[model samples]
Target chain A: MARTQGSHSDITGPRIREAALALFARHGYAAVSMRQIAAEVGVQAGALYNYTPDKQSLLFRLMYEHMQDLIAAYADQDQTEDAAEALRQFVGFHIRFHLQRPDEVFIAYMELRNLSSDNFAQIEALRRTYENALEAILRKGQAAGAFDIADTKIATLAVIAMLNGVMTWYRAGGRLSLDEVEQAYWDMVHRSVTA
Target chain B: MARTQGSHSDITGPRIREAALALFARHGYAAVSMRQIAAEVGVQAGALYNYTPDKQSLLFRLMYEHMQDLIAAYADQDQTEDAAEALRQFVGFHIRFHLQRPDEVFIAYMELRNLSSDNFAQIEALRRTYENALEAILRKGQAAGAFDIADTKIATLAVIAMLNGVMTWYRAGGRLSLDEVEQAYWDMVHRSVTA
Candidate 1:
């Protein structure tokens, strides 16, 4: 049986993306080239064009997909109605989601400067949507008298950044178990918001 | 007026580091070249070698100095004996110091991957020293029954990471003034570590 064009692209597209993400994460986006990505994907340079138009598009897509995946994952995991429980779940979810995708997280923060203005705006909007999800949770908690936050927007950013720090130093089989790490962060985050 | 070798180096060394820091922050370490940095500083490419042996040295010096400056600044400002007051001063110092040097802070986090192992080790040690200072404060607070931290090291990192997040969005004429931003973080940090 011959391989269909759909199957051929389905296989190549992900390969191209994986190779691109790794390269851009290892070397900054400005240092990576189309030829290098094609080589990493085991394809001709011209073949990459069949999937994405250029390097900028490739960077945008990686960041865009990362944000989308995060939003989707958060949506899937969150089922709580109580404000405190919701915040706890968000802490665990954010830490585990980000820790597993070190490369994506690295590229997501590091390569934002490389995106074109239009692409930057688009990525920024997607990021804001995700941030809004967290802010809404904080707002709910505030109205319910569970959280004593001065500024929900600042609180959202602080919580995310605090969790994002785990990716920098956390390793498998580290001193603290993942569950323990998550619990410690939840403790801090929970206290920071509540009275 | 005759310029001595000392004066010549004093002027060129700083200029070279400034140009390299901007270029590295803008395009990344792997993407920037000595030729480009020299061009940015209005010097010949070969002239850059006289101040710094190579690109790696240039990158390392920029990071090393940034860390040193941070340590020195922290040492100079922290004069309080009360653990709670000391922690508050740290929160304000970290935010103000980092906010003034956006490019340096960006490169310090972004270009770690590009450093040679030796250079990386030195930078990591310097970083740990800074972290230890914060950890020391937390320890004092814990011993004094002022802070209810599960893990002081983790708490130190979480607080620093949260304060660092301000660099990504805070601006001179933003909705919040600098004092307000510092106060907000100090509030969250103080609450998170204390009962």
Candidate 2:
């Protein structure tokens, strides 16, 4: 079907991205088509091209923006020398961030292979930067003797894994409040790294 | 292309499945076509139907068999009353199983939603059974006062989540041996749970 002209507006970009995120999360990147995403956004197939050059670019933009957002959010937090506090901030921030932007989180995790090699490397580097931030906190904690961990790198990965796993089963209206989930995860993290 | 006719040989089914598993893992389930799988297995597309009714069934079979194999392996282990030892066994088994069967593990985790509702339920039920095995160990540890967990269900989920995450980054031929990875994971799990 011919896409209506002028349908690509300021709002359409985010709308298309949002629709792509959901579809990618539900059916994965390879299975989802530009037409399906366009339909979901209530636009014509050709109009989607006005927003994204191609499906790959659309997927890349979604993942790239999500990673940038995560890095920004973590950067905005108050700097603290206290490793435990820093970790708590990281944990709390991660849970809240993923919860608030479930679509982006889904896209970032599920559509890595869909991006071109350069795009994949770009997104992966951003991810590593975020991960290294947490690792720095863990290392500091170890130095201060406030926490005991066998391996800081592995521990960082473990904590992030546990937190990211929440997206797999967490629902918006689930019985456990996000606060409770965060607390439970914090407790687990505390136990894992503490002496 | 038309599928070549082959006698209903026992090896043919496994061949088709093995080829499908590799392709699915490399390109993802939705991106892999039945014809590609047939070509990989040296058969025509129609010939694949003799083994599997459709592409979805092929995916389900791989996932289903992986779970079954996991449960069976654990079942063969000698009975042990020590919760920690049993938990260690579970972790070791899981890591080794996934590492050895990367294709199956990839499909099971990555292409779960591709299954029909009925098939999804069956896979989910098998997964719960595996999860229950871990939960039982946690419950025993809690009862013995060896583990300090606020919620066994949450703790079990957290522990499993962290353990399962090893697959995302683990390489089959990496410098770190599977035994070493298992040991590292076991150390983390032990430290996380033990009081």
Best candidate according to DockQ: 1
Candidate 2 has a TM-score of 0.94
Worst 10 residues of 1 chain A by lDDT: A1-10
User: What lDDT score goes with residue A21 in model 2?
Assistant: 85
Q: Which one wins on TM-score?
A: 2
lDDT of 2 by residue, B50-145 (tens): 788788888988989888998898889886898888888888887777777777877888788789999999999998998898999999988988
Give the TM-score of each candidate.
0.92, 0.94
The models' CA-based lDDT, in order, is 0.90, 0.84
lDDT of 1 by residue, A43-65 (tens): 77888999998889989999999
What is the alpha-carbon lDDT for the whole of candidate 2? 0.84
Clashing pairs in 2: B3-B44, B4-B44
True contacts kept of 1: 0.62
Q: Please write out the lDDT profile of model 2 over residues A1-195, one tens digit for every residue.
A: 345656448889888888888899888898888889888987778888888778888888888888998999889989898889988988899999888887788778767866789998999999999999999999999999989887777788888888887877878778788888888888888878886
Report i-RMS for every model. Answer: 1.2, 1.4
Docking verdict class for candidate 2: medium
Q: How displaced is residue A142 in candidate 2, in Å?
A: 1.3
